[model samples]
Target: MRLETEMKMLQAKSQAGIVKEETVGNASRFIDVSAKHTKLPHFQDGKDDLDIWLTRFERFAESNSWSRDKWSSSLCALLTGRALGCFWRLSSEQAQDYDKVKLALMNRYDLTEDGYRRMFRS
Candidate 1:
């Protein structure tokens, strides 16, 4: 009965996405029992529209129940070319902020309100 109780507790922890810490001798390691990692869409400069891509990314993140605070790092994984360059140019602190990163990308890609108006006029 005691072993069954422990197994039930372990199962509950797994479902809650808890990290298990195991220590052997003097060493300790963390085991991730979280859900499977979800892959975000990759952004390709010139090929993908920044505005549309960002919208899609947000939707995908929401659908996958990704933590809002982790979106910056998660989005960073799929950036490439000029988009990736813009991320790299940000200060370490700014890079960690999704809003700042999005702002920088929008500015770099000329997606501001005036820029959109100019595009529409052209």
Candidate 2:
């Protein structure tokens, strides 16, 4: 009976993890879809354009007095797909910046100047 209880507990934990992962995945997809529809100045590549978009977003967020959490979440939603594909192509420092931004968003309203490094990392 104890073994069975432990197995059930493990299964519950696994299911909970899967649900969290799905939530994150859905959020990532939302980001991708939003990015696809956003209009921007013409650029050579989508990945390059993503940088410009992020800069514009930061400026807008600042001007509007957006909270750090809002800015981070919005940026993550915008860059999620592009980040996955282009991050590896970026420099080591650039990748670190991306990770920082992502972590900040995950942590909520706690981003810093370092998080903005992603804007120039490309």
Candidate 3:
């Protein structure tokens, strides 16, 4: 009975995830990112606010049922100019290596100058 209960719970969780996916667009690339001025699905430039960009980017990634690799790859492809340049000469294709891309972006853009100081001091 305990085993059966656990199985049912797992099934329920999976079903819920499916339902959520449907709501977020189970099809290809949730929003027409190319059509938008931001060029990143629901994201906006917002004076290069990484917080706002990350939030929208995450939602976009999730909606398209992307993995970490896919998330990094897609974002890398869409980013251009200074935003794209920060990847240390790595292009969208090379930056598909999720961990490396994520680390570089977060270290440079996500963290404030003070945050970096605190990180090193700690």
- The numbered model that scores best in lDDT is 1
Candidate 3 lDDT over residue span 5-115, tens digit each: 965765565554432212345542223323433346433344556656777887776775666756776776666555566665766566768667666766666476787
Candidate 1, residues 9-118, lDDT tens digits: the string is 76667556575656799975556645445555689887999999999999988876668889999889989999999999999999999999999999999999999999
What CA RMSD would you report for each candidate? 8.5, 13.8, 11.9
The C-alpha TM-scores of every prediction are 0.72, 0.31, 0.47
- Quickly count the clashes in candidate 3: 0
Tens digit per residue, CA lDDT, model 2, 1-122:
99789656655654543211224644521122223344433223334544445567767666654565544445544454435444334555544454455443323322346645664575
Order the candidates by lDDT, highest first — what do you get? 1, 3, 2
Minimal lDDT window, size 10, model 1:
28-37
Task: Supply the global lDDT for candidate 3.
Answer: 0.60
In model 3, the runs with Cα more than 4 Å from the true position are: 1-46, 91-94, 110-113, 116-122
Worst 10 residues of 2 by lDDT: 28-37
Candidate with top TM-score is 1
Note the residue pairs that clash in candidate 3.
Answer: none
Q: Is candidate 1 or candidate 3 better by TM-score?
A: 1
Off by over 4 Å in 1: 1-38
